[model samples]
Target: MKKKDKFIIIDGNSLAYRAFFALPDSIMTISGIITNSVYGFTNMLLKIINDNKPTMLAVAFDSKKPTFRHKIFKDYKSDREKMPEDLASQFNLIYRVLDVFNIPKYQVEGYEADDLLGTLATQAKDKGIEVLIVTGDKDALQLVSENVKVIFTVKGISDVNIYGPEEVIDKYGIGPNYIADYFGLIGDKIDNIPGISGIGKKSAAKLINEFGFLEQILDRVDEIPAEKIKEKLKQDSEMAILSKNLATIDCNSPIRIDIEKCKLKKFDEKKVYELFEYLEFRKLWEKIKKMNLMEKSLKDENKFQSRTKLIVEEGELINLIEKIKNLKEISIQFLGSNNDCTGIAISIKPDVSFYIHIDSKEKEDRFFNLLKPILINKNIKKIMHNAKYQLKILFKKGIRLQGLIFDSYIASYLLNPHFREHKLSEIIQKYFGYIAFFNIYSNRAITIYCC
Candidate 1:
């Protein structure tokens, strides 16, 4: 027997809405594009992709037109508030991001995202594809079964509670199949769907669990021990049935499932990086950069040319700083972590760069003492990639660099923003069409120098 491949279906609109609310609306790029919703949705997306390692994926979005449920009641989800303009603005960007990832997205004019997900999940499960439906809606729990599970966003965007049929039973005191029936009796106030006038959760669950489904419960409503409960069920019988119909997800959406199109593929890194740059999603880019595929993509390092001369001795460091003191423009790369840096690399020209090892206190002191003046001088331009990181490393040594004339990182951000990393290798290959070759040692700092 072979292991089954997993197919992950997502409710895009619901999760996007959930994400918009989960994060602060103030999350925007420097250019002033709101990204909280996209951030939240992407985080959930990356988490699911990484955690599940699903081989097939699809995201179903809701159409603007009313679904069949609305046609049935005209008031289905009518009470729900319209989406805010801020959230509406992010949908396009989110869709662009999805397209960059090569993930298939589906939307039908007459159905909700959940309905599409339910349909796809059913098809996937029947075909022996292990199906996982990811959504922020509880109504999705109705689709949970042995082969199909629901990953429900519980509190925050990333925080989720997975529900199998057994979990659903444990949660609601009824099986997954009876979730719609439960809602039909109690009603969902969020959607303005009406149920029996006086029925509540406890009564709904008790009736659904005992008699199985709304129709069966209605068939035996006359035998209820409580007259008030029985009377409510009988009086609003039509409402109970209507709510059940409303609650039940249509597992028969007209949309076709294209497993080939949805097959998990390498994400378009350039496009994703571009979006991240425009969104000013620095941390998110770093996370994406660490993906295994990205790591593999970075292995093609033929374009890099080694540019720095290693300065192991204190005298060499003093000479390097002396050369920097007279230069009009210079680039420096700090080689170390936040706690401790091992060395620095300086590039005075495209081909002429120097590296200084700061292993000893005397060498470190000499390097900073000689270079500090040029950094503070208003004339000599300081150029570097991710200048803030270098500044932080230098700040750790009590040196405040001032002549911040150019930051390639900021320049690149202004230019494209989506390039994966501002490392010399990428920058050179991108702009100069050349490889930037440099050796990275365990004991040395990682730095890129540009002039």
Candidate 2:
């Protein structure tokens, strides 16, 4: 039997930028400092650990100075603008988080993250490690080896398509080894790599896979039927060479750090807890304390035990209402669909130890009947991660939640609007420092969180 092996690598800068722009420019630290990118980036890293039980992990970042590629092609990456001033400020906080997680971060002064990733993928493959390179760069495709796979973030880091040998063939219509040649023939407009003038993506893939390389395709110009392609390849010979050099990733950069430095370790709860407290994340504080009990069991080596803490039937109505009446404050977490919920599946918790399911009409009435009395009273301060959505649904049910107090999502946004996402699941993952989850039932397109 072949044992499963997973070696994870990340493009830290790319992931952070994608996450930063994915949400609104919200989420901030105390004292009016923005921490949106910090929040989003940290949650992404946590997501990978909680989902994939990778035996080894590393994150690679770009150096401040120009890489060797820039020296080769002066215009290489020249078109891109500087990162937002707000985003640049939060970069260090993300780095501190990596340190807390005991994850290895690799960077070389003259080498880009692609170089570090290429070298690591090659090294891991030699040692029988199955590498999963997480990056937004297409240049990392060249690093895909037989034992290595690439997971490109598709939409919002919410979904990813795993590209192995077969997937590469299906997706790009070329193998890993031929990606450089393909890039060489068809230029990257983003990187300013000048490819053959007339040759587009379709022609480039065919020529690269058929002739084996950019140089070889040029050599056999007589065989190429397309006169435009032949002329472009012949006339732009210098551009082809430059493009290949730009496209080919430098695997032998001087960044010789070991993966041992990147091992996932215990997050300093005190540091994270202090940060949350400083931000006034009380619900977040509670979630963290709860997960601390299961921290040792969840982190490191990428695994966690998910179990049902409680499940109440439709008949357990009064017991739940009786439970809610005594509580002064509560955290409301709505599960099921985000849309209209008359078919609204709701769950309300007056306390962490007690979560009541309102799946049926009987239980929901008792839960809301108790909740309705409080809706009119302004003294009873209420808290919900997303108060507006809950407000909309609860209002439809004749419950006007008048005096809502706080929203972790809103607080997180004010702290750093650039930090963007606001799902209960992600908020828990970020501020609470725990992996928030909902076991999604595909048929119903419904998500139910198992606390």
Candidate 3:
């Protein structure tokens, strides 16, 4: 048999809510934008993608409008508190993250995310595809079958329990199909579904296992062995039916499932990097770099070509200085430390760069003297990765590095203070999608200049 295509459906609202409460609210950006929910959600998403490697994936989000359950039952989810302002604010950011990952997201006006997940999972399962439904809601377990599994979040965002048909049976003492029935007999306080008054989990499972469904048990109430249980069933038969209706996930929700569109594909690296940088998700950005899910554009490749000129002759050095003298800004990378200056790389333009080797003290002195005017010019701005360190090296040589406008290392640190080490190679790879090759041990610097 051909290997089945794996389809992963996420309950966006449920997972986001879980994540919001899982992490502390102190996880904020430099601008005080709280990102606990987004960070946790993205972390969970990355883990799922890395673990399952699903062929197709999508996230189903709940809309602001009241769903069909609310229409049928006015008390549906009425007991739940209003969403926190901080968590609500992060939803759009999470959506942007999904877009960057090239993952399609769906939200229907009158349907909950659970219904949407059910619809997609059922459709995929019917087509002989393996379906994985990710949610914190236990109601999703009803969707589990031979080719369907429910990744139920048991604790916080990280810990989870996977429920196949067998696992569902093991847990509930009933198959996945009777989950709604079980909930009908035992009310859900969270959703405010009024199940039978006297029935609990054990009694609910027993009834569901015996009579197959809520209707069957209600119809055969007189045959029940326990008189008190039968009376409770009779008294709350209508409520039990309503509760089952409320608890049951609608597998035929009015949404189309385009399997081809849901296929996991390469995402635009630049856009993803921009969003990550904006959100200040340094660890996640680093994680994405390791995943290598980005497609390098031909433009990036064409714009970056190594055309390095080794300036050995004095005439060559003078020509380079004259060429870049009038430029408003330039990028410089220093190789080696202050004591042992090895070489210096300068770039006047994006594609044009030059490197001058400093093997002896005489050569270092001569190079600094020739380039001192341009380097010390306050009008001509300079950009470097670690400006402070480079400034120290330049200061020791009596060349005060002026017009230091941007320091990428400091910027990266501000973006993510939790980062242990903000290396230039990692920064280049994160933003430019280019693997910078240099000898760290030898203190060699590879400079790619861009305005």
Q: In terms of lDDT, which candidate is strongest?
A: 3
What is the C-alpha local distance difference test score of each model? 0.81, 0.69, 0.86
Model 3 CA lDDT for position 290: 87
What would the TM-score be for candidate 3 when compared with the true structure? 0.81
Task: List candidate 3 segments past 4 Å from native.
Answer: 298-302, 310-331, 337-343, 348-351, 356-387, 391-451
lDDT per residue (tens digit) for residues 294-380 in model 3: 876413443444466667777899998888888998888787786867778787877777777777888888888998999989899
Q: Quick one: best TM-score, which candidate?
A: 3
lDDT of 3 at 154: 87
Off by over 4 Å in 2: 1-5, 276-451
Cα lDDT of model 2 by residue, 28-74, tens digit: 65467776676667667666766776768899989889988899889
- In terms of lDDT, the poorest run of 10 residues in model 3 is 439-448
TM-score of each: 0.79, 0.64, 0.81
